[model samples]
Target: MLGRIAPNLLIRIAGRTTEAGIPPFVDLLRIAELSGNLPATDPSSTPAALLTRFPHLAEVTFEDVVVPGPHGPVRARTYRPPHPNGIGLVWVHGGAFIGGDLDRADAHWPSLEFAHRGIRVVSLDYRHAVRGVHYPVPSDDVLAGWRWAASHARELGVAPGALHLGGSSIGGNLAAGVAKRLRDSRPGTDTIPAGLVLVTPFLHPFGAPWPTGMLERMRAATTNAVVSPEDLTHMAWNYAGRRSVLDDPYAFPANGDLTGLPPTLVITEEIDTIRTSGEDFAERLRAADVPAVVRMTPGAAHSSMSRPAEPTAQVTLDAVAEHLLGRWSPRAA
Candidate 1:
């Protein structure tokens, strides 16, 4: 009976012990199943609810779509701009591979922002690696949504070859895996995404090694920034459901060859323990001759993208929007 852990709940409760006598821990997925007052994952919000939170999005058209996933019908939310930019993004939200949904801030806030920037965004409500679901299922849902968007680009107003794939945290791992799968499956086809965006992603099974003295520096900054290596391994193993899946390139892109992957942008939180994983992946992509860029959000923690009202969060997303727009029209941006 693993209780649902809300996004960023670990950070909120950091250093606070439960009445059950369990030691204070910062890992959300490893929390003990408690009976009362436990935080729950948010349900998908209606358009009215969304607008109440973001009145500026009143002009942005939102549509709820049902895409055919291999497992079954996958629900998705589409954000349409009042003015189209001919660019589109199929985005995934993060929750350490277990918690989160379309209502999560990481999903809808960024989707609304990208749409406001004139890039049509389709945010997927992919299955989580919980309740007996494991690797390949969530990635498969994203693949199905991508294919659906690519096939209907004309009606969707997204230019051919202008669509990008991206995600944050575990969602980033799934997006990258699906990108690799597309490249391998199509070989020479143009069905792959034109680019990829990974924000504070957890790429490796045990997380990447921190720079010399970096761990000390991060701890001094904030305890909330520290995600232990054991926790990373636990999350990965939980998502995999078996040791062998950890070695599967498609399951964790850090273990795979990234030679032919699309241009990539890896955004990291300055004080987060998982920052190195995203940074290391960027270096690996560059070593493989792929165009990869890494940007660190100043004074931020992991999952900061979920707080849209925060200045640091605004700065991070503005950078993401700039990258997408610049890639499409360099002269205009």
Candidate 2:
């Protein structure tokens, strides 16, 4: 085992690579050199470092805000565009409920790119499910962030009707829960998001059945990075603080009604173990008559969003931007 290396150590390793003008791909390779337990050529490179190498483009800028939360003030960053398109996103980043920050690649790059293209993004820094924090805490924080954004949409330069809620990985699970809570608790039309964007999400504790032989083919492949169903079950149990809470629909949206949810776009990585969870949840949404579209970035592994320099990550990011801009048509169910 590599043992638990301080995150700062990994950050330093990635930071040195970034300063040397090394490609993002090599940053993780250096980290993986520590042990075989770590995947060689993995997407685990800290995106916060790699992305800083690029020059800032356009007139996009960001502001830090303190939003009121159930526990206390929640930290958030808002990315603003020179021109507003009336679309805004309340974004969440993923770390399996225990880690991740606003600067993570999933949250930062997308917010910057979307803002450059004329959409505003409010990225949340919610409480993680660590140090006795559990379900409904992180959920409550996201709900609080959404409420703040919705109530101040005009001042935030976003149309109330066009504000969206979205997240990736475990963050997606949190976003889905917030959407469900708003649907059930608030009856007003303006409370819900215009649509949902879920990427490489883990929706089910035990994922839907894999496409026939898909699991076998993936395992046979040489990739050292893979997240299995058992891995997801462990994450769910940790977030819930107990096995029973997994049944809580708000904790895991797959356990609740899929009807009446907003139109959604679910993006998956081709070789990820969690791919089926997103795909299956989208189909369930469609079966419930909610408009849902699912797409897979070919040859992508999990955490593709973390490597923005890669062509596959670019495709994934474009899919989300297109969905928000209404520029791309959803694939037929």
Candidate 3:
């Protein structure tokens, strides 16, 4: 639609150009080639490359750090803005709950961005991947980080009562799970997040590899099918401990009871398979009397924010800032 609008017509025209009938499987092939494919698996190395690429990103400042989780230490980096902090964002890093580190660039970028907007951001580098320490384990570590942050909110310059939880991709999934748990725990009247900001969140695990009823969408599309069906099945089992896929809350938040979650902002790219997760969760949150909003970015794919200065990339960050600033308003309960 932007292609038909006013000036800047040429750029939109160029961006809009695509094979008229190219299969969506083409997207899967490109993503599959890169999704689980890692030339260097170290989390720090992954973000270091991005830091080298985007030199202008501000450096992260840590006022305090902690790794007090039970199973193992998860490093946390806190980013504090200049003045009295008005809001706090407990950010969980994304790595399919198996791989991530606060020392890495990807983990720091979002927090750095939040700090620049005057919100105190704590990024978590929780235990990941290995058996006995995944899924809800990561969720536990993130909530631990949040508890630590809340305890230190005053010293960290955060406001009297404003802490919002945020995450991206799988981290967002963990945050949603943790938020539900926190809601039920209800430690006290004053100990809970104000809202949730989810970016390209993977809210559902039951999404089939292909669209429903597509018997051979990729039969001839050799370039597609990232993470073979075998890997998908294995990941589900590994994530939820060998349970039937039908009733695993860890696997799908959309299928869970969301009666009391905070207001939520969920941004999804149309090209990602997990887009369904974001949309369904947002709608469900609203249906259950929780405030929620779903924002979609066109002409983009998942993982675009980690890439360079694409329009969608900046838009994604802007959405994060808006949520932190209390500019986002999901429907009130």
Which digits, one per residue and each the tens of the lDDT, describe model 1 over residues 1-333? 233554455435444543322223323443422321224333334334557767887778788899998999988998899999899999998877766777778888889878988999989878777667888888899889888888878788999889999998888898899899998895655388988999998888888997787766776775454665666787788888898999999889999799989999888999788999999999999889888888899988786777665568888898889899985432221
TM-score of 2: 0.83
Tens-digit lDDT string for candidate 3 (1-333): 321233233223234322322213223223223332112222333455556655544454554477687666667888866543578888886655554567443466667667766888888867654535445666778778877877878877778768888787777877787777677784683367888888877666654334663323322332222223433344445566546643656445666698888888998865665666688788788789888888887755664455434566677788778766766456532
* Clashing residue pairs found in predicted model 1: none
Best by TM-score: 1
lDDT of 1: 0.79
Instruction: Please give, for residues 75-133, the per-residue lDDT of candidate 2 as tens digits.
Output: 89998987879899999987667666776777787788888889989998788766667
Ranking by TM-score: 1, 2, 3
Q: Model 3: residues >4 Å from true position, as ranges?
A: 1-56, 83-85, 186-190, 208-232, 244-251
lDDT of 1 at 234: 79
The residue pairs that clash in candidate 2, if any, are: none
**TM-score against native, each model:** 0.85, 0.83, 0.76
Predictions in order: lDDT: 0.79, 0.77, 0.63
| Predicted candidate 1, C-alpha RMSD | 4.6
